[model samples]
Target: MEVFVARSHPVDTHVGNRLRQRRALLGMSQTDLGNAVGLTFQQVQKYERGFNRISSSRLFEFSKVLDVPVEHFFDGMGATAVAAKRKPGRPRAPEKPADSDLNTKRETLELVRAYYKIRSKSLREKTRDLIIALARD
Candidate 1:
């Protein structure tokens, strides 16, 4: 008899990271997400951490709630990640450092949230233009 332990796949972690990024970008709390999905915040945290696998249906639900397409979760994944085949007893590849991605940064998310909260469309456009102009300097 063989006993198998299920390890988290890189795809799962990637999806979880995307989920966290989207949630943060929208300024939604874990509790709010959990309430929408009929889950506890702890469960949401587990999903965000890739400790629990998300089902297709649940992922669809998340897509609806997050106002993104299903493909959003899979976006930015490399071909290597998409084709990963892990063997038992083999060590997993090291994950990229959390700080490596600008999108995953707390400051980036906060800035996005604040920008959205501006309410006035023209103000938001001007704010975006200002940031872009500043970056070009």
Candidate 2:
């Protein structure tokens, strides 16, 4: 007889990635998020790693504490990941999207945090232009 063991859903992974990104962007530690959401840091770590699924109510609470809309967690998830949430068994691996590169990189996140910290809009724009020009070279 075959035993059916459930694996982590792709949507769950995507949500976790979003959660981690948002938390990092805010410079919040796992302990900080845990305290805000009434959970342990280990629980927050599990959620961020997609080792456990997040309940809707719990997700809503996280959204409130993170200062983001509930939909934010679902952002950038592909159709395959969304569909996997509705189906029962293990899902097929998804195709990698080109733009997903930046999203998965620590450097990109750090750059984003630093970019937002720039107080002057003109300076930010100039910096953006410089980066674009550098990227073309």
Candidate 3:
């Protein structure tokens, strides 16, 4: 007899990362997202952490609320992440070193929001150029 142990799929993690990125970029809180989808914030957290697999209908609802296409959640997912499905009673694939996803960071989101709030086109360009120059050092 085989037992099925639930594990987070790499695809799910990728989708969750995208979900978090989009939500944060739009300045939406987990509570805000939950209320829009009729779920609690904890449920939203679980979804964002890939602990809960979102249903297709729920995903559609999220897409609608987030003002994104349904395909957005799968953006940037590699073929290896898609192919590494977990089987019943099988150990999950070893996690690869993830590239630093700046979009998923709260600091990055805050910085982006603050940058847009500058409101002057030339000032924004100067700020961007300054940051790029600083990064090159």
Best by TM-score: 1
lDDT top scorer: 1
Candidate 1 vs 3: which has more TM-score: 1
Ranking by TM-score: 1, 3, 2
Candidate 3, residue 97: how far the Cα is off, in Å: 7.1
Q: Under the 3 Å rule for N, CA and C atoms, how many clashes does model 3 have?
A: 0
Per-residue error for 6 in candidate 1, Å, reads 7.0
Distance from true position, residue 68, model 2, in Å? Answer: 1.1
Residues 1-137, model 2: lDDT tens digits: 65666666777878888888889888899999999989999999889877799999999999999899999999888777767654455455654532365775678878998998999999999999999999999
Q: Quote the positional error of residue 5 for candidate 2 in Å.
A: 5.4
Every candidate's lDDT: 0.89, 0.83, 0.86
lDDT of 1 at 67: 99
Please, what are the lDDT tens digits per residue for candidate 3 over residues 9-127? 88888888888888988899999999999999999999888888889999999999999999999988888887886776777656753337666777888899899999899999999
lDDT of 1 by residue, 13-118 (tens): 7888899999989889999999998999999998988878899999999999999999999899877679888688776767786568888899998898899999
Question: Which 10 residues in a row give candidate 1 its minimum summed lDDT?
Answer: 90-99
lDDT of model 2 at position 2:
52
What C-alpha lDDT does candidate 2 achieve relative to the native structure? 0.83
